[model samples]
Target: MKYFTVALLAARGAASPPPPLPAAVALNSRKCRRSWWCRRRALGGAAGGGRMALLYRATRLKDRADTHVFTFVVTRSATREPDRDVTSKDFCCSHQRWAVAFSRTDASLGVYLVWRGACEGMRVYVDFTFTLLSRDHFTANEGFSGKQVRFSAGCAAQGRGRCITLAELTAKFADARGEFQLELTMSKVRTLYSCELRAPRLDTPPIAFAGFDWSVSASGGNKEPLTLRLVRLSGEGQRCRVRYALALGEGERRLHSGPLECVCDPEGRTPPWNPRPPSRILHKGVRLTVELVWARALAELAVSAAGRAATCYDRDKQAWALRCDTHSETVRLHMLYRDVHNVPRNHLRYVSWSAWLVRASPAPGEADADELPGAPFEHYYAQESADEGLMMETALRVEDISRAGCAFLHAGGELRVRLEWGDTYLLFQATYHVYDDLCRLHAHQMRREITALQAENYSLERQLFSYQKSLAYAQAQAGEPVGAEGTGRRSPAERSLSTDTEYA
Candidate 1:
């Protein structure tokens, strides 16, 4: 009975429909509507709207978490089929906020640019998307380091899905004069996106000295009868290179010793200072050491273990350096050994800088020889005591202690001798603190070697893939009926490798 009455009432309701709603009321209820007032406002009050009629509508997708993604649809009033004007769209986001916003427009078609956030504050990762409404080519120009960079329709261009580093983007517009312009050119028309640049300054100061020092140190605390002086090779106030001369003995017997030259630039990419060992000059049985300590520069270098040897080895120059990196600066420690034949020239051998010197036994009559001393780690002091029991001493300097626990100097040990008629003795000790950081330097070198080897290994693996593929192709051509199942014959090269992996 209840079902029959319900059906009878539903039929009566369907027979008599409700009255139609008013035009204004119906338009107001829908999500979007065309308004003459809005069109007039878009025309800028009698200035006359351009040929392009604009309309814009926004739809908001809401989630349970209360977050929203607003998608905007724009169209032309005259045609409802499809709008082919927009080629691509990209947006940035940061700090839990969308970097772009849009407002509705009443004209049949509209184009707007919404931007926020400075280029300097841009994070390392940026998100962007491109929408291709047509097949026209687009291009943009950015100024960088006094050159113009053209970003076109191909790779690195704005696309459907893309991300870029802020540093890279900032570098592109680094030299822009307060503003950046993006140009989109088509067969029939051209559109543009221009915005003021808010990137950080990218000026690097001209090289200038922050500090410098040059001094001498002596062993045995004796006042030697020698003089050392430095002459500026460059002009006054110039700090690139320097020349020095040494003199020994006094009065008319004074001997003019080595006049050596060294280059020190505290303002260069790598400051020539303490890390760079002193120059060693062996002349007339006397050794002269000259070094610059604590120099400051405008730039720094990449740090390396084996000092710089692990990463950089120049066979022609025959020099080694160490580098350190900081947020704002990179520091380099450089050392140059003029005639070191044993130091490896190939970077691979120096990866760990594991090899060190061994103390060799002193040759007979070495104290009487006129030759300068050998490497510092080698303890080779000779003695010949006289009746009066006179004694002599030799102090050494080394980069690291040898296997026998002996120390060396910058590259070689220093030598000082006091001679008397008849017999005399020679003694030497290593300069321990001169290269106290040798162990640390070696450790860094090991790390660099490991990283480089890993990269090389990966590259070899990739190459092996190609080789295996070629081998598989040859085996298939041989008509051996190679099957995907087991029990297939293997090549000797493939069999040698223990891993039973196969490439098909």
Candidate 2:
């Protein structure tokens, strides 16, 4: 349960890759507020121009500053490290000013990032929502849906990076309209030292933000997503909230189907939709990539009773994530099948990636026609809008064009991974590959040389055996001239080389 609280809390604060800034980039977080939010205009799409929100200003930690803390309601701990599930009747997110930041003077990272809040009374205890442990390994959502946790949390200091996605949660949060009901109470609390809310974006190259057409595209310039993360405080007579806001010149939004997660107007009238994003991508410490592949290749897959499948598996172990592959005439697809493991609990294999061509490969003659002007192409992707978006462009060779959506394709590329431990971030490069003709040709030639060597060796042995027999017979005949039992005489061909020629 403690672990779950930690994970969930971390998951919400996760960040996407910040845009490229010129000078030394510092950790900076701002308030998520009505004014700082994008403003609405009469234009067709979004228009950016909103007031900027104040971020947590640097402050030194004073001696043992007054603080408050609380446990989560209906939360479950995981045997796994850095992950937890919490069930709370309600949870709230609010934007309140935090005076101090992470530094030697204040609370440490371990103490700062926890499920806690404070208030004014000398001694105060608030009945905020929290998850309680009952008996063994199971969990209860507490009549609510959505739970989340973070994994491998410790590192942020030594470059340990993190990315966490939480299942949707419902909490009682305050509104910008100053609604008292939504307003959590905190008073007389001294804001001293706290962990710096702002995190610097490592020179980590941004991975392709991938298909948003609602392939949403991020302008290397403006219109990027920004977010601020804060803590909530509540006690007998006092309460305060930390705020998070989205950033600009960074991330993107996508076309979505559900109601906006943001609060709406109270009048039941049209909500003030100040230039909202279709979707915002998280690309910071951990970069996420989605590869949409066809189903046929994944058919023979042995899905277990737990909805988990793998060509090979670990015993009684969770099979939520498995790397498997299938080669079909249409396209060979490799999948990272996931069970109900991820925070969102998506059913279909999580991150199913396969390579395929949308149109039949250009015919032999059409091959030249392909590079022709404006030759449109159908791309192999999961349910994507018309203009497919990709952070990185991948090139694939076409196989049979007449096949269904699921077809075998050949694709190879380089993978850059972002991993963090403590305060340090580690990057790894893995190159995905498919056999090329040159490699195959070299292999074939090696096989041919081996075969030729074997045959020549066999022939040489046979010739040596026959020659030995003939030489023995000739020597025996020479030993007896026409009838002598033991006299030896050299053969005419051998005589000149070993013995002097007789004149007579």
Best by lDDT: 1
Off by over 4 Å in 2: 1-504
RMSD of every candidate to native, in Å, equals: 31.0, 32.0
Q: Tell me how many residue pairs clash in candidate 1.
A: 25
What's the lDDT for all of these models?
0.26, 0.22
Q: After superposition, how far is residue 438 of candidate 2 from its true place, in Å?
A: 58
Residue 149: error of model 1 in Å? 14
What is candidate 1's lDDT per residue for 23-70, written digit by digit as tens? 231112222222322332343321221112211111122233222222
Tens digits of per-residue lDDT for model 2, 191-278: 1111111224312121111010001112221234432221111121211111112222223532212232221122211122222442
lDDT score, candidate 1, position 249: 34
**Candidate 1 Cα errors over 4 Å, as ranges:** 1-70, 75-96, 99-114, 119-125, 132-480, 485-504
lDDT of 1: 0.26
